[model samples]
Target chain A: MKSLAELQAIKDKMKDKVVLREGTGEIRVVVGMATCGIAAGARPVLNAFVEGVNKENLSDKVTVSQTGCIGICQYEPVVEVFEAGKEKVTYVKMNAEKAAQVIESHLKNGNVIEKYTIGANQ
Target chain B: MKELSLNILDIAGNSVKAGATKVGITITETDETLSLVFRDNGCGMTKEQVENVTDPFFTTRTTRNVGLGIPFLKLAAEQTGGSFSIESATKEENPGNHGTTTTAFFYKNNIDFTPLGDVISTVTTLIMGSPGIDWVFTHTYGEKETRIDTSEIRAVLGDDVPLDSYEVIEWIKSSLEEEYDSFYK
Candidate 1:
């Protein structure tokens, strides 16, 4: 079993680093996680974003989280991106691969992969 | 669902949606049976709601016309020659003691039994998705066991530090993997 003491050590070491980035992210990536979303394979999409953001070293600027049903059962596995002073962008019928693309294009380069957006699906 | 862990994630999400401050999940495996129990300290359902929960068409959410989380889980267990049940006490009925407990038993020997895949990801996802909720998880395979309590972790890290921090989430994933590793060794 892993000890709580080791967890304590991690906290002590990362405490300062965590404080610097706390609640100050400029972009938010929210994945739909309701029943509809889960059945449509949103878990991997969510994981892809989290891992993608971490791997790209964008953790300080981007925060990936989850939301409940967005009322679009036909378009399950939805993802919404919220950035300061911009219209919220909704992506529909997403997968892990698309998530990585979204991170690379929209989150990284400020190019909102409009092809994957809900507007294109509609 | 393709995997049982996904069902666990879906069902536990219900607990979170119910405003549960603390959720307890236990997976006990034996030679023939795999049992799952999810208990929460949240607003429970009424008798009528509990009765309708397993119906695919019934849902608490106004956003969608159907709810499949509970129904699918029930089907998953029953398909394996197992059983599923839910008990709840609404806040109006039980006052401060309101909550829900869902249990399912699966006969692992049955051909229809689904594999429990990537539970570490399911758990870490839940923790990251809802850091304010204290999640207590325990999985026992015969004599070996793996356990984690977010409340304990929170006590160590204190309120200023969030459980969903990248480093914290990574630590949790590795810790769980280490525990599972010891089980095999």
Candidate 2:
């Protein structure tokens, strides 16, 4: 069994890192997780983002979160990325593979995959 | 949804929407039965709302005309020759005790029953989305049980650390993985 003592070790190591990132400008990745989003397979997309972010060591620079319906059920499984001063870029009809690509192109490279954005889909 | 875990995610999303601070999810499995219970200390709903929850047309949101989460869950459970129910006490009526409880039973032996797939991911996703909420998840099968409570982890980590931090999430994942490993052993 994994003990709480191990959790303490993790806390001790992460305490300084988390404290350092407070209020720092970072990119925000938000996934739509309402009924529409889940039905359209948002879980894997969300998972892919989380795993990808952690794999790339971007946890400190990019925060992944979830939100309810965005009033665009047709664009279910939507993802939106927000940088400090830029307009929010919403990506529609996303999947796990596409999520990885977004991580590589948009999050890691600082280039919005305009083709995947809701603007192009609409 | 293809997986019961997805249904769990969908249903619990309502609890998050209702401003729940504490969410409890319990899964109990017997030879022929798979039972699920989701309880939340949220804003709850009106009696009328509870009565109409299984109706696909009933929704509290103005942004959409249809709500399918409860209806789909009801259909999934009933199709397997099992049962589903929801009970709630609104804030106006129950005040400090307001919340919602949803119970569903499924005959696992039934051919049409959906599998509970990748529940660990569902739990982690919930925590990642709502780091402040207290989540208690327990899964019992045969003579073994696996459980995790965010409140306990929070007590150890202190309030300064977010539960969704990558390292914390990784720890949660590995811990659940270890417990689940022992379930089948």
Candidate 3:
């Protein structure tokens, strides 16, 4: 069994140094994680975001976080992408596979994955 | 919620938003039983509000109409061959006191008790990471018991940053996974 002290040490090491004081070209990926979002499959979506960012070695540039009810439960599991200076792009009804594409096209190549964006789905 | 811990997180979030000063969470896992109890010193709900709490369309807050969290927790408990109950006192023996306590119980099913630890950690992390909320989490497995206080973390954190920010989330995930690996199997 792992001790609490061991866990605390690990936590201290993983603490993020980058602060989002002024955005500074950082990419923010927020996943809805409220009850409806999770029931609709947000966990895998979150895992995908973490995995995709790591796989692309973009962990430093992109930060993934979970948010409570976005007041749009029907569209969950939703993923919102915010580039440093651009308008926020919301992706509705997302899954792990869609998250990967978002990374490949949007995060990497700077082109929005049009088909998965909220505008295309609507 | 995908996992039991997330359910606790949602409920604790509601308590903190309701202006709770202190929250208590207790998890018990033994050979025959698995139980989770959460109590808060927040604004207690009325009888009508309690009745409507399980209704998906009845919400006192303006954020959204669908209230699926408590109902989901009740269902999760029921599905695991267990039960759930909620108690509230708008004005108890004291002249003007109000509080609410919710407890959900589940029976063991030949699975290890390590998952209970994860559930406790999740609740602790969610409450600790949020601002202006204090939480005490107690976990019991047979004769062993562990208690975690968020104030300790707050002492270390000071006013520098929030507890549940991006970095803390990763740490919480990894720590819980490490403590409850067998349960996930």
TM-score of each: 0.96, 0.95, 0.72
**lDDT of prediction 2:** 0.91
Residues B1-185, model 2: lDDT tens digits = 88999999999888999999999999999889999999999999999999999999989988888999999898889999999999999999999899999999999999989999989999999998888899999999999999999999989889768788888988999999989987866
DockQ of 2: 0.75
Fnat measured on candidate 2? 0.80
Candidate 3 residue lDDT tens string, B1-185: 55677677667666765567788888887777878888888787788888878777887767867788888788778777788888776654333556678898887683422233236445534653354677777667776665656666555555554555444445555644555554423
State residue B75's C-alpha deviation in candidate 2, in Å: 0.8
lDDT per residue (tens digit) for residues A4-120 in model 3: 465455446544443532134389989887777867877678778866886787876787777778888879999999887799999999998999999999999899987887898
Question: Ranking under DockQ, best-scoring first?
Answer: 2, 1, 3
- The candidate scoring highest on DockQ is 2
How much lDDT does each candidate structure score? 0.92, 0.91, 0.70
lDDT of 2 at A111: 91
Q: Where is the poorest 10-residue window by lDDT in model 3 chain A?
A: A16-25
Give the distance in Å from residue B78's predicted Cα in candidate 3 to where it truly belongs. 3.5
The TM-score of predicted model 2 comes to 0.95
Error of 2 at A109 (Å): 1.6
